[model samples]
Target: MSTQTEHPPAGGGAAGVAEPGQSAAPGATPRQTLTLLTVLLAVFVVPTSISGTAVALPDIGADTHATLVPLQWVVNAFNVAFACFTLAWGSVADIIGRVRAFGLGAGIYAVASLASALASNVIMLDVARALAGVGGAAIFSCGSAILSTVFDGPARGKAFALFGTVAGIGVGIGPSLSGVLVQGVGWRWVFALHTLALGLVLLALPVIARRTTEPRRQGARIDVLGSVLFILAMLLLTTAIVQGSQWGWASAGVLSLFAGTLVALALFAAVEKRRDHPMLDLSVLANGRYLALCLVPVAASFGFVTMLTYLPSYLTAVSGYSSGTAGLIMVLLTLPVFACPMLAAKLVARGVSALTLIYVSLGCLVVGDATLTLFGQNVALMAVAVPMLVTGAGMGLSAGLVDGQALEIVAPEKAGMAAGFLNTLRLGSEAIAVAIYGSLLATVLASRMRDGIGDFPGAGDPATVANEVAGGNMTGPASAVDASARGDFTDFLVRSYDSAFHTILWVLTGICLVLFLIIGALVRTSRDGREPSAATGSQAAG
Candidate 1:
């Protein structure tokens, strides 16, 4: 069969095969249409969840009286849980049945959102957000599996394309919709919005489940120990980042969290080495070309997703936009994601190399991030248009291409692990990037607060005020100022935030450029020194 027509055979996948009742027909049936829509709906929401809630952070902090440290959890917990549990959920789907897993995940997500909506404390909201993340993991992992069983051949490709598109749309619209929800209905309504959509998914679950089936993994043991260790490592690492800001970075508690993360990761490696069915096949890391390719999404995570998480806060706080306006402006950054994946694919087909497109993307990210320093307290839509579009385009170009291209060079048996690891790195890096950025921003804001503003009566603590300001609660500083100096104080705060924002963006630019040099050389040198596979899509792309 041509590569385009190929589809998986029975018992042919790591996730499991479609069972007896499942159709292998080439065209879509009403049942299949329903299944596809159901799966796509779930797919849409997961990425939306990842991107949306960041816009509501200011409201969340103000309402809950949380500082930036715990407030960071509102975003990090979701990313951490979703990234850590993704592969494990795939294993669970194979055992419990994909449809059952899908329904269960949707249920968990709905309940968690309800809890998030009702939570009066930031801690309660953070925990619920993490639960939503776990549910999101199952939704995407098994949602893909379910789609495979319901559609066949050409339609399968279309289904997956739509799957990716809907996901992008979800991400593209999440901030804006979330902003509107926060602005009009209040931040709690953001979680309530998810509850409403997911509730409908649950209503259709029984019908969706009846239309498909997959064989159970009779004796398959999930690498539970490996999963646990990975989760521990991620949780510890993110905790350290958030805490290093609130506590001194050199504090023993912060140091201990860092130490604990390293130990957990070391143990995870040891556990994976001994597992019969390791969640990750470590051997793939040796392929320098493959490793280099995986950095495509890493670049996107650091360059683009971090903006998704932080920029709304920036626009609202430093740029003096309302949350709704900030969300609308963010459309410039997210819109490219909706269309660029297909454009990249078409360019590749037209004889442009995927690796070239990847390099171009890195260029866009570095240039865009650096140029985005144009944003100031008087930010105009026109001033940010070019940079936001460039950054969004950079991310959009590589969203799905990297996965397929990365898998092509490795042995077929390793593809699943290769993919699982690639995505984990992508997501894990995103979570860390958000934490690291927030931590850096917090540190900068604090220093400026103490030095630039000086100590004023009723100012509270400089560090506490910085934390509050970072969470978009400028009232902390405002409360300290006399009415006459209030205008000057707010202006100074904006300047402080602008400087910090610029510093972070420049640092991120340096990281992107350094990575491009390192990975670009690795791909070129490694490809020349290594044997060419029957698949040199890497070479052609390189």
Candidate 2:
């Protein structure tokens, strides 16, 4: 492991030891406050940017005249770039400097946000969003890595809890905030706000206290080939998933994308394993605890974050609510995120095992997804709200506890890489979840609509009807469809949507249940034999 002594500021101590620039004091100096403020701002804003963008998607689509596929690309582009570049940026942070990487990320993010706000077309917006993801990856990796290096022991736990809480609040508030912005100003203002916030942080960056440089490893090189292969694999896989329903699952285009994904992923794994300095250290997978920690987030994010992206769209489209109202209803899904993390942190401090927390979280997720599946349609909004709350709480607890616990098992020098790896799983799962859910929803909706509308009189071309309904544009007037048949079409649209929603929810529930059992088994066996110190209770306090 690499070791380097971190120097404290003239008047401040290192992170977690004392308040910066204060002598064993409980309070922080102005400089320390600025440092914490700067880092926390980035932590909070990145998640905010993601969820806020989700809320703005409807406006973006309407303004840019984007179809469903391009709309999916708007979100997928950002997630793909963020997921692919995070580990590379993490490694680079360790190589160059965390502060420098962070500054660069913030700058890039600001510029990209401005470009997105000014984008004239869907293609430009998508490209800008993808570039912004590059910046987001750097910010996310460096923010957590910096915290891991600065704090230790119980203080590390506390700092991370705060970090998680701030992140949760950002996630919780993003949709509603974006709703207000989009409603009051315009969709453009959403990206503009991100640019403004990041610009302020950039101005304050130089004044923050700087930490000592992390020692660089000798003969270390970034795995450029591995990164390219991983990016190509993820891109191909996501493209296949997103386009499969539209193109036909067995179509040559879809099949080719899947084949390309398999090949790229195989190449990526081989290259990473052979490289002396891989972007991701494959040896970490040998540690069962570490591997479990990495995967729990993947499963959790698949169920949790995916819902956050689509639920508002559902509310607005199927439920006949305005975007602002959908944003308000989304509070049920995000509020617990703000409250549950601190509670989970307290429980962990009181000796609750991280594994136990994870197991319970998965259980909560299963129940939540199942409930949502049952109550998605032909029910009061309250029915959906209850499950959203449950799922949100589960997400909060899992996200709050897992990252800190995952870091505890790794060497401090590799903190950036570990953080990068953990988030890559998270954001990567997010990208896949969105693709799968979107495709499934579209496919099922189209199938049901086609079957139902075939017998309807004067419903115009069945293909056009199916396309419109599947795209959630059921209210649009069509000349081919008789006015008398409109009511039946609306009913069919609702039923199709409800059925699709239930199918997706059921799949997610099954995923949570299976992952819960698998993780439970891993924890039981590990506690019985391997790494008894960690399995017992040594690492749980954090």
Candidate 3:
């Protein structure tokens, strides 16, 4: 069967797929609808696993008797694998068919989820989560490529908006759902539920979508060396950042990891430039507009996504809230995620420029991060809620448009590679952000706690006490010096956390400001200095 490239316009057309004011092609509606549903379900599954599993970390730790390092790995292992493999999968999807790759990925994800649920140890759980990330890479890489290929013009914008909304729901509701599961049933149910949902998606995929292939160069080869080098670089960098506090920043091991990362990155760039069919088209980076599109998400991941991962931990550990209460508080951070994407889509469809929206979003992020620095132990929930909403709105606006905008400039045939590259930056930066943020928090909290505990009688080893406090074990024997010291230590723990949180917020605020200026300078505009119409249907796809 020949592949159909002509999508129905936003208004009613030959294709029967009814978008707003549009009609689908004859016999196309059902397949189009099913394809969309499958992608949405696949997209929703991965992020839900990410945020939901974060909420269940405490439970996972308790049940597995995991230490701080192993617990961090449980989260980072997934992130690392997801980041490392997305670009590789994107190329693989293009060489094979997107639908086939997506199906295989869904199968892998479901199996890994089942394994995660049945894991008897922390190591086993980490391994399962990492495998799930491999699947997540394929799903994320192909999902956008498929959507980009299937939809065009205003329909594409609307489809991505709906896609963003689904993603928002997953990010917003996952923690709350996980809280319910962890509290009412068990943490294991979290993975079990994902397994069931994805299993169904896998079964329905073949029926919903037709197999389609992209035009590929006859001698094209996957850049295996580039992939290996990039993965090694990311692995070493992430390890150095995550373990810097524990290993001591100046220690030989941490320094060697950092050095190795630099060397690997250099080698990867060298190899990619020499290859005819590079995993990533480095030429894409030369385009200022595309570079901005790619890098903005990296900055946002540092400021926004990192906060999403850690805020729940803070709410439960430092603020003395239950996991359920923490989830409720997180709603403030996620609700706008669902709302802003649709708003952005409507605005773009009405001739508003995506560049303008991106600028506004980044501005919100800067303001939100700066505002969060003002929070303290006595700060009201509404205070945190306000900044979170602003940040969430920023995330929502950009998340929907960034991928679409990046794809606008790329050739349709290279859609998979572009999508993979975009996500590689997005998720890779997120993984690094977690490490950097975690490092800063650990280092500052330990130092502050050490100073606060200085000269306290019978407070054996300030480092040990600090570790216990940082780990949220405030009532343990390590933290209890005596009756009189207990109250002081409690006060110190709260104060130290406040200090660390403030420091992180301030640093993120700086990052946001720097990125805002850089993006403003880099993104190209029309001769009149107005935003370009590329994000709308005005610009033809390459």
Candidate 4:
């Protein structure tokens, strides 16, 4: 494979896989598809592994006497490492061979899982989780690159859809599966299962890479300094976001982190400008069309993250549902996500821009969320199901479409870098969205509760009244409380919570509507960028 020419064979050596108009040996059996699938699936391991651990937090704390902040870091450690390294690993895979790099990541992930399973303390567990993040970065980064390298045209679209669908399912199922596994046996078994999956994937590697052993010569050098700067910038920014609620947002530590992020980011750009082969090619972002495509995920992710972060609370607090039931309700949002990618793939094949589909999906989400806000209590079970289905479908469609399309735009040699760039933006978007939108919802909920209670005549001593109402100990009708006599005895907390949720939904709708307009504009440009019908057959005619 190395003896082959350094450059991609004319119409061959396509990104992820061979595509129409790309070079390929005649009658070549597709070898990398399943390999790519396995790699992508490996990305789910951390989520699946750690998800079970969350349910065991109380047990863990009881056993280890872990403090709240330290215990919280157990989760944040993985998130921080995973989000920061995704692009870095993507870039590294581009420099090396994707398979070799991905396999290495899998090995690390497997070992880390085992270590975490056997951990005797919180510090050790956090260390193992961070290591798993490092491995996760490798898996996710190259997974996308591998898919892009192995498939082309409509096939590529469908492959990405499948990948996204599976990812959504893995995340959704993780907690439940983990809980069940932990109950039936123990939490250690969760990580042990990952080791088993790792072994299987490793065994399949040879077959998966049979036709893809050729090393790509990208003539690009790794910009290590730039990567370091980027890591710092991301670390500071993400840390600030994650800790601001617990820490005083105005504290010097938080302010210093914010300042550090800006400085590191600036330094990263300067360093990359001087590097021969930068870890991230900032030029890709200069393309207006690409920038617009990038915003599609960044903007919509706010709502996606918000829903995932806050909805469970809604379920438990207001809907009177159990934690398990709340988990099931969330499935309404994630289950449909898996199917949307496939649908979007079909739509993309039929002259639709991927961005258009993402827009449609987001629009659907806005509708579903709005419906829930306005008539959530009044709607029947089937009616409730309708919005959830729409939300899930929209998420599915939006998740993977741009990824596939973005990879398609770049040359085969640049696939890794492109993948890294896209993933970096996306992961950052999701993290920021989760933090920012979550805070927004919190603020709104708190404000609404404060204002609504203050206006209620006899709800004296707001904090005490709220505490009593929340605890479900308040007696007498909520409306029966006379202005003068209802001191600290009001009982309409659920209704107040509902009103706050309603306000949040309206905000989401407004944001989605704006995104829709932007998406519509981007669709026009994306359509123009695709190969014309005449160019689709035989040679791409580039």
Score every model by TM-score: 0.78, 0.85, 0.86, 0.85
List the candidate 1 regions with Cα displacement exceeding 4 Å: 1-36, 53-77, 91-104, 110-129, 144-161, 175-220, 349-351, 377-380, 407-416, 447-451, 454-465, 529-542
lDDT by residue (455-516, candidate 4, tens digit) is 66655555444434433334533544675645442335666656667787778777767876
**Alpha-carbon shift of residue 114 in model 1 (angstroms):** 6.1
lDDT of 3 at 493: 74
Candidate 4 root-mean-square deviation in Å: 5.2
lDDT of 1 by residue, 1-542 (tens): 00111223332222212343444454677767777788778778888777789889998999999997799889878977888777677656655567787898999999999999999999999999999999988787677666554555445445555665677898887876888889998999998988988898888878766545444444556677887898788778767765676676789999999999999999999998887666665655666778898788788878898998789888888877887688788889988888887777667666777788878889999999999988887867798899999999888877666654665455433333454566677777886777788877888888877876664555667677777788787766786788877877878777888888898999899888888898898787667866344221222223
lDDT of 2 by residue, 116-210 (tens): 99999999999999999999999888877766655554445556777778888887778678889999999999999999999988987765424
| CA-lDDT, candidates in order | 0.74, 0.73, 0.76, 0.68
Report clash pairs, candidate 3. Answer: 11-22, 12-22, 12-23, 14-25, 15-24, 15-25, 16-24, 16-25, 17-24, 17-25
Which ten-residue region of model 1 has the weakest summed lDDT?
1-10
Question: Candidate 1 or 3, higher lDDT?
Answer: 3
Best by lDDT: 3
Give the alpha carbon lDDT tens digit for every residue of 1-542 in model 3: 12334433211131222342234332345556677788989899888887778779999999999998888788778877888788888877766656777888889999999999999999999999999999999999988877766666676677778787888798778877898999999999999999999987888776645433233323567788998998888788877766786787789999999999999999999999899888777765655676678888887887788788788767766788887688678778788888988899889989998888888889888888888775666678877778888988878888768787777665555567878988888887876787778767877887887765674677766566655565566677334477777777677777777788888888988988998888767664332335443322223222
Better of 1 and 4 by TM-score: 4
Which predicted model would earn the best TM-score? 3
